[model samples]
Target: MTQRLRQCPRCGTLTPAGECCGAVLQRAKPWRMTKQLVRNLHIFAMSRKGLDAETYRLQLERVGVTTSKDLRRDAYMALMRNLRALPDSPRWKPRGKGRAVA
Candidate 1:
């Protein structure tokens, strides 16, 4: 006997086992992947400023952080804190006597 496919509640379409309906699942949602990307970007930016992952991880552990999630969270928070502490924005400007026009 053949197993019947299940109907998706959101789109009323048939879906196989362990699959999701296309209409019900959005393709542009960024919440799932953005966090890791943001974390890596932050790490890369920090590295450009002379801070490496091992050093950052040691600093976090010195203050009682101990897991991958905690490390990423702390790194994100630290990056935000450093960014907020900057006196000027990190945008490019023309190399001349004229002031930067935003």
Candidate 2:
């Protein structure tokens, strides 16, 4: 049987599938990092969902997306996109207000 080698996206090292290379390369390049930062900042500012910068940072850290500045930005953008998809108005009926009468 022939075994194929998989290249690690992080370290660029080739190893058998499901094996750890023990080294992580930088995920995002410098230029990409700058661009992503700008994009994420813009999205956060425009979002009406009231994104907190500190919370977003924490979330990014939890998700293992903090390998580089660009990765952080990408995570922020993803959050903004998710928030934008929700309905703008509340769907719940008020407790006091019953059905409207004709």
Candidate 3:
């Protein structure tokens, strides 16, 4: 069998084909994945706990997601980096409007 070599864009190193080259080979963007996960999680949480969109948004904010575009960047990295945080149960909400709290 012959081995193939490919150049790694990260460190400008040549690595054997079919290798990870010590870098993450992301199939899709972290934000994209997190977005989808959030959507599904929202649906599930809503059905199980009566979480509305505003409530969900507030929950996300409490977990460090603070803005509409925040989820697309650093928040994405935060979610993707820590899988343990995903399964966490929703926290208690103080009595008030979600918008006012946000």
Candidate 4:
């Protein structure tokens, strides 16, 4: 197999195939890190629901993930953001009182 090496943009270190220098970059950008966290959370939720690989891909696609092989942090964030923006039903139970009740 041919070895593919690429220069890391931050440190200029040559990374071999199957490796990356994104960890440091991700740490530097809290928003990117948060997106990674949300992706992990989505994976965790999918696993908790006993979803298989195919089912997981389907769910990801439902949220605008075009390629299962290249799922991006932005896509995960968009999915979560859309989920959070969902409108609450008026018939739903009212939110509980705050610490004063507790």
**Number of the top lDDT candidate:** 3
Per-residue lDDT of model 1, residues 58-78, tens digit only: 545654554334544455466
Please tell me which model should have the higher lDDT, number 1 or number 3: 3
Structural similarity to truth (TM-score) of each candidate: 0.28, 0.30, 0.33, 0.31
- All candidates' lDDT scores? 0.48, 0.50, 0.52, 0.51
For residues 3-97, write the lDDT of model 3, one tens digit per residue.
Answer: 54565567656556444666744333233445666665544455435556787677667658654445656665554444334453344343433
Model 2 Cα lDDT, one tens digit per residue, 1-102 = 855566677667766656455644333343345765656554443343344566555545654564335455456566446545543323323353663422
How good is model 1 by TM-score? 0.28
50-99 per-residue lDDT for model 4 (tens digits): 45567556666877774433546677666556544544433333354331
Show the lowest summed lDDT stretch of 10 residues, model 3.
93-102
Q: Is candidate 1 or candidate 4 better by TM-score?
A: 4
Best by TM-score: 3
lDDT rank, highest first? 3, 4, 2, 1
Worst 10 residues of 1 by lDDT: 24-33
Stretches of candidate 2 exceeding 4 Å from the true structure: 1-37, 72-102
* Model 4 regions more than 4 Å off: 1-39, 66-74, 77-102
Q: List the residue pairs that clash in candidate 2.
A: none
